[model samples]
Target: MEPEMLQRKIIHVDMDAFYASVEQMDNPLLKGKPIAVGGSEARGVVSAASYEARKFGVRSAMSGYMARKLCPELIFVRPRFDRYKEISNKIRKIFHEYTDLVEPLSLDEAYLDVTENKKGNPSATLIAQEIRKRIFEEVGLTASAGISVNKFVAKIASDYNKPNGQKTVNPDEVEAFMEGLDVKKFYGVGKVTAERMYQLGIFTGADLKSKSIEYLEQHFGNSGRSFYNLSRGISYSKVKPNRTLKSVGAERTFNVNLSSEIFMEERLENIAKELERRLQKSKIAGKTVTLKIKYSDFTLQTRSKTLPYFIADKSLIFEAAKELLYQEKMKESVRLLGISLHNLNTEMKKSVVVQLKFDF
Candidate 1:
């Protein structure tokens, strides 16, 4: 690893069951109970499940019906995205108080580059504990943190002691910590990839490191290189505070499935209009238009068409979407439809390399 990479101090903070915890916090009656945030109807999908509910197999993206079947006593509440965003902003404000190099991955988590911070604090371990402490005291919520030499290790460590806990992987501990790590526990290696790794006798970081980069690239494409570096705790990806917008999209799930092309087109038109509004609001134009379709059985498919010119107008966007819709025959009744614009004009940005150093 490069000397600068080893010097970088990164911390990943993640809220504990953020949405469900917020619901429990606002209403004390829900505390310590098995609760899920999302609709309870048959077609409803679980957005977030409290730890209590997780014991019964309730999880985000699981169908509400299945969640109930797993835990019959589970309680369901509607999602309040506006309220979630409000709290998220408060948390980000706290992060900014420590460092301007805070990169939010979502409403619940973020990566902070604090090698040089506002607090003049050199110990990343102490910084993580203090940040988690402040989040609980000020926001009436708990957060867990992981401190390490780089973003990848920090993110994986954050999950070590979850539900309001913190872990710090000093520079000296990174190698052993990563080698013993289960392949499944490596960040971004989903079930499918893990299964593939297992098939190849790569059950742990050490197993992954045993393979040649050329061999891995042959099996996993570009991701092979990423796997090779992460296993050795050698990621150079910085904490990017101002992440670029790669795509803008809008999707809708209907209460009823539409099988007819005419009905689907009517819904697509409305979705196209919404997409146009979003693009105009962002003051961006793209040359590629993609249409997403979700079937009643919950399968997803996407179709994309790259035009000769950039477009943000509703008519042009709708026309492109319409052509993609008719370009293929429907296989099943459609439950969801979405439109997105990609390859935006505001797509290029220069990356800066900063000196990174880590210490406990």
Candidate 2:
């Protein structure tokens, strides 16, 4: 390990139930109530749910019907993304006051490298507390923070105490802390990965560390090295600022499935227009166009085509999407339709060729 790695101080800050909290803050009547911000109860999915709703197994990304079944008294509210983005800007301003090395994960979460901060505070824990305090006082929202020597440990530590709390793990304690942690709690270990780990008798970081790199690679492929490094409390990934945009896409689930070819074409055109608008707003064009379809029975299918030139026009995107749609044979009624553009021209630069002439 590099000596400077031990000296780095990183902090991860995550808002507490961001959208739901914003709703509750805007309307006092929503306080202490089980509420969700999403589509109507008759259709769509939950974007965010208040803490009260979570107690009854209601969670974000869950279908509205299932959430209602879990909590009969759940109140559904439409999302206000513009308002959330406004508040997020205020929080980001607070982060800038302390450190310039801020990497925003989303509107509600970000990572900060305060190893050398503008405040010259010398203590990452104190910096995190001050940031959280300022967010509450200025933005009227609470945030949780985690502090450590690296991004991985810091991100995990931030979630240790959620909902307006902070936790810090010093460099010396990182190894011990990781060894005792549950494998399921690791950042990238999702439900399927956790189940696989359990079957391998790797229930904790200590269990994962016991296996050799080759053994792990044989079982888990490329991610085995990541698991091995994280189990030993070693990470070198830096907090990237101004991360590049990867893809622009839009998707919508219909309240009723569409089986007619003409109706599907209309829906595809709308989806393509939305994607074109987003691509234009981002000032990006892509060579690849992808069409995604979700059947009523929950089956998903995707088709993609790469064009010779980049395109961002609505008509062009719609035409490409229409071609891909007809190429596939429909097996079931589609419940959702989506269009996406990939291989974006966000950072493409013109190449320069130099010629050298030698004189004798």
Candidate 3:
């Protein structure tokens, strides 16, 4: 990570309304209205809601009933993942034209490592604008771009302008941006963390940075390290390409809530080991495993384990997950549990598609 060699140039591109936008682009009648793509029936929640719907407080994963209540004009439509994936592939191709150092965050968003890009662009800011413009012109869809010295800032910058726009945050501007940004606007800091920060008088990055590292660590633990560095506009993570999701999963909610951590741990461990054995049996390895815990109060928290290498061994999986159970504070009782495999691969339990994109 030499400073001169790293001259860090990063861009985070996020498609506007993604699934809903693709729907609008493909269908003429759906434009300029509050639309959502999800289960059309009342039993479902919106998977991707349009900006118009967002104006009314309707959001993704929110119940259809609630969405309808928020926006009386909301129109629910069934999802077409196939179509969305097709569009995603197209956008990915566009990204490759600029640099192979592209990391797709989702079908809708990605991080581009353009420190030494093939496009020969001097500024990552211009590259982002050009990419967003090309997507609009060629794909008939709007995308927003964020430009900064690192992925963290770029990811947030892209969202500042909303749909059909782009923004840049240079190194010198980082201080002003962070100082003005709300604690809630941070990527991983959730509602609970935001409230805690507010109570601690950390309403903005300036407020956040004023707190000493020891104070932050005492209050926020491991996440505080990230907060301190981020408040200084620094990030050390790399942008790996064509990342494969390690473990596939399924989780169901119980009518009853588990009152004890031991019961909850066992329930979660079983699910993890079951999935782990299946993956090992298939000869796949994963580096990161995540635990999704939902409490009786309907509040959710997640913890993750990233090993030195991919491993699908049941014992290893269960042990790491069990350790995570005690690593976090869980005051509320749990109602649901889920496990997912991430940062997976084939070489050493590698990604199923890493080779396909790696050689590109």
Find the candidate with the highest lDDT and give its number: 1
TM value for model 1: 0.93
Question: Please, what are the lDDT tens digits per residue for candidate 1 over residues 206-267?
Answer: 99988889988998899999899888888878888888888998888888899998998888
Residue range 31-130, candidate 3, lDDT tens digits = 9999988865355668899998899998998978799998888888888977998999999999999988888988999998877778777777788888
Candidate 3 TM-score, true structure as reference: 0.74
Task: List the candidate numbers ranked by lDDT, top first.
Answer: 1, 2, 3
TM-score of each: 0.93, 0.94, 0.74
- Model 3 collision count: 8
Off by over 4 Å in 1: 4-6, 351-353, 356-358
lDDT of 1: 0.90
Q: Could you give candidate 2's per-residue lDDT for residues 1-360 as a string of tens digits?
A: 554434578899999999999999999999999999998777789999999999999999999999999999999999999999999999999999987778899999999988777997878899999999999999888999999878999989988899899999987788899999999877679999999999999999999989999988898899999999889888877777666788899888998999987899898888888888888788899999999999988899999999999999999999999999999689899899999999988773332212121110
Each model's RMSD to truth, in Å? Answer: 2.1, 7.3, 7.6
Cα distance off (Å), candidate 3, residue 43: 1.8
Residue pairs whose backbone atoms clash in candidate 1: 7-356, 7-357, 7-358, 8-356, 8-357
Instruction: Provide the lDDT at 189 for model 3.
Output: 92
